[model samples]
Target: MKAAMIFDMDGTLFQTDRILEASLHDTFQLLRDEEKWEGDTPLETYRDIMGVPLTDVWKTLLPLHPTHVHERVNDVFQDKLIQNILGGMGALYPHTEDLLSYLAERGFPIFVASNGYPRYLETIVEYYALDRWIISSYSIEDIDSVDKGELIRKVKADHHLSHGIVIGDRRSDFKGAEANEFLSIGCAFDFSQENELREADVVVDDLIEIRDYLEKVK
Candidate 1:
């Protein structure tokens, strides 16, 4: 049976922790300079909220400030994030290009299924020239919700894929795969809680492990 491999973008394919943290820091500072907030929220405190939508982030943080202040802050934060991406400030994880190329050479049907915004996904794929390696890409914009499992199911149906797997750094990735009866591989090199990683069908700390697993499954 042919196998389709879908990967998550943020912590899975690219190491955006620093970039995101820095962007948030710049955004909060900009808000403070504009007198939008009296103080800054630490980046560490916001790490758990990283993959969440911007609108949700605003809603969560808005309680700390007047409701009238959230709209402007959200606008400024988004502007700064866009600027950061366009400024050539972000980077992919180590060995990502090599791993992707390896999969492409092996004729694997590889796709990027991510919760990231569509524009950001487009920018990163173009910037990395990943179009050559990836068969397709999907973002949260393609779906109405952030449920990764639902997105995987949609991909499976749309592509007519019968067998496949998901590789990601979060427990939701594994749960999504399980929901669709697909194998889940947790990436240990990326950020994930220990309990979350334990739920994966397999766990690996390197890309070569994925290549090996694919071979065994085939």
Candidate 2:
């Protein structure tokens, strides 16, 4: 059977923790400058919410804050994040390019199925010149849904893929793949906890493991 591989961006293909931390700090500073919020919360506190939706982060951070203000904060944060990435502030995970090239050279269809906004994903892909290796892509905006499972299903349908695998670094990524009937591979080298990685069909600590898994499956 032919198999395809879908990957998540943030904590999967790229280790953006430091860059994300800086962006959130800048975002909060922007909010403070605009007199939108005056809280004692630090950037580290928001780090845990990085891979999830921005509104979810706002809800968790400022539950009592007004909805409109929360939306505005997310908007500002997204804008700042784009600017930061465009200014050469982040990097791809170690061996990311190697992995993508390995898969592409083997004639395995590869695409990115991420929870990030389409524009941001596009920017990152273009910045890294990853389009040459990635055959297709999908994002949260394309599905009009934040649920990763639904996004995965949409990607599968769009690509006309009957069987595929998902590689990511979060529990939700694994859950989404399982929910959509795809084999899930967790990348422990990124930043997921043991329990989260356990949700995947397979857990890989390095790109070598991913390559091995693909070979075995093929």
Q: Best candidate, lDDT-wise?
A: 2
Who wins the TM-score comparison? 2
> Candidate 1's C-alpha lDDT?
0.79
Predicted candidate 1 versus true structure: per-residue lDDT over 1-218, tens digit per residue: 46788998888887777477777787788777877667666666556655565556677765677666776776666566667767877777777888888888877788988877777788778888989888788987698887888888888988898988899988878998999999999988546667888999999887678878767866
Task: List runs of model 1 lying over 4 Å from the truth.
Answer: 64-75
Worst 10 residues of 1 by lDDT: 45-54
| Candidate 2 lDDT over residue span 1-218, tens digit each | 35788899888887677477777777778777887669754666566565687668789877877999888877877787788888888888778888888888888898888878778888889889999899877887787688989988988888788988999988888888998899999888645778778788998887667888767865
The Cα local distance difference test for each model comes to 0.79, 0.81
Give stretches of model 2 more than 4 Å off.
39-41
